[model samples]
Target: VKQIGNTHNREMLPSCWDLTEAVIRHLLNMTDKEFFYWGEYLNEKAKQRQTQYKGPHQVFQENV
Candidate 1:
């Protein structure tokens, strides 16, 4: 295993698989309201950027 930071902000991931596993675990742990809020935040941010760069408002919930 490798530690990525100091004690106050450390991450211990043994492999690349651990990174994905941690990400999925965190996402799955969010409440319905939190997830919706996160999606809305992302969409709004994307919309702000869309004015300057044409692209999709990539949502994180549906794909997860």
Candidate 2:
């Protein structure tokens, strides 16, 4: 569990297994709405990256 600046070093994962497991676990733990909601969150985050956000930003909702 490597943490720097409140972020975990995802690159430290030996392979994609941990990531896949985490996604599967998240899907299994969340409801259908939650799954789609999470997907929207990811989409918004991606957009934020494209927009060149330059501060401590949080993606809390889906982009419209």
Candidate 3:
């Protein structure tokens, strides 16, 4: 049970990481087109993460 919980947590990490990367790029003045592309990628990752996600972050839920 502990291992399964750990694995689920690991699976959810990528979406958060992608979101952080995108936000950092935005702060760095990344182009809108480039940011959109990254957003799309993050959206995909968010969907995948949704399968095992249990967090209450509204951004993920809204985007997903």
Candidate 4:
């Protein structure tokens, strides 16, 4: 998780790590096929968002 944050050049909050760890623990209980499909789904979503992604600050300003 730390490596992922570092790779993205983002500073992850402790709560983010906790949430990720919780999700990982839940994923671990899934069957191998289920886990593989989940990984593919997440990767696809990430790719789809890669081009027009907005940071948190931008989102907040737009909302405000």
What TM-score against the true fold does each predicted structure earn? 0.53, 0.46, 0.37, 0.44
Each model's C-alpha lDDT?
0.76, 0.72, 0.77, 0.77
Worst 10 residues of 1 by lDDT: 54-63
Clashing pairs in 3: none
Mark the regions of model 3 whose C-alpha exceeds 4 Å error after superposition.
Answer: 1-26, 52-64
lDDT string, candidate 4, 2-51, tens digits:
45435444444456878899998998899999989998999888766754
Q: On residues 1-64, what C-alpha lDDT tens digit does candidate 1 reach at each position?
A: 9877676443553567888899899989999999999999999887777666644543443356
How would you encode candidate 2's per-residue C-alpha lDDT over 40-63 as one tens digit per residue? 999988887856864434343332
Q: Judged by TM-score, which candidate is best?
A: 1
Candidate 4 at residue 47, lDDT? 61
- For candidate 1, the TM-score is 0.53
User: How do the candidates rank by TM-score, highest first?
Assistant: 1, 2, 4, 3
Worst 10 residues of 2 by lDDT: 55-64
Query: What is the Cα-based lDDT of residue 64 in candidate 3?
Result: 86
Clashes of each: 0, 0, 0, 0
Scanning candidate 3 in windows of ten residues, the lowest lDDT window is: 1-10
